[model samples]
Target: MKILAIASAGGHWVQLLRLKPAFEGHELIFVSTKTSFKETVKGHKFYSIPDASRWNKLKLIYSLICVFKIVFRSKPNIIITTGAAPGLMGIIAGKVIGAKTIWIDSIANVENLSMSGQIATSIADKSYTQWPDLSNSKVTFNGNVLS
Candidate 1:
């Protein structure tokens, strides 16, 4: 399977990396906002997009464009993210291209899903919450990346 794994820098990137083992035997392509993350995902295909936040309207638009281009060229069968804005952009682009998407809410959101996670619940083919208590009709609690 061709998998496009995307996440922003910092905690989201760390959490996304932890799921690498789960994607074993697949053709994994990674996308992050920082070029510095290339070292962490050595030996895999990696792409860097501009970092943006919900608060940054202009940059977010540019990031979305980058996501469209990457997703189009990669032609992944699946797209997965433990996210922030950049991850959400990947999910949106994946949806537009008819690729399946999985959104794993960060373990740090112990109390509730992040804003991006909540949005992903409606768009992602599968949406997961690390906390069992947060599971609902739209989101499932399978296993966590941290575990």
Candidate 2:
């Protein structure tokens, strides 16, 4: 199985890495905003996309173009992310290409799902919240990346 794992830097990236063991034995490809991550993700295929934020419209556009190209080429069987902006782009691209998508909301968002998480509920095959209390009809709490 080919799995595409994507996330932005910082906490989102950390949480995504925590889920690495779960994809063991699968062909894993990672996408992140930092070139620095190439060292950390040594054994896997890695792609670095331009970082963008919701506030930066131009950069967000550029990121979407980059993600579209990457997703089109990779054609992953599954796409998973712990996100901000870049992860959202990956999820959107994955869905358009028919890959099963999963969104794991960052542990940092204890009170509510992040904006990207909320958007993912509409498209992702599954959406998870780290905090069990935040889970509802739309989202599930089936354990967390931190575990």
Residues 13-99, model 2: lDDT tens digits = 999999999899999999999989999889999999999997889999999999989999999999999998888898999989999
By summed lDDT, the worst window of 10 consecutive residues in model 1 runs over: 138-147
lDDT score, candidate 1: 0.94
lDDT of 1 by residue, 36-116 (tens): 899998999999999998888998999999999999999999999999888889999999999999999999999999999
lDDT of residue 17 for candidate 1: 94
In angstroms, the error of model 2 at 122 is 1.1
Stretches of candidate 1 off by over 4 Å are none
Clashing residue pairs found in predicted model 2: none
Q: Which numbered prediction scores highest in lDDT against the true structure?
A: 1
lDDT (Cα, 0-100) at 76 in candidate 1: 99
Model 2, TM vs. native: 0.97
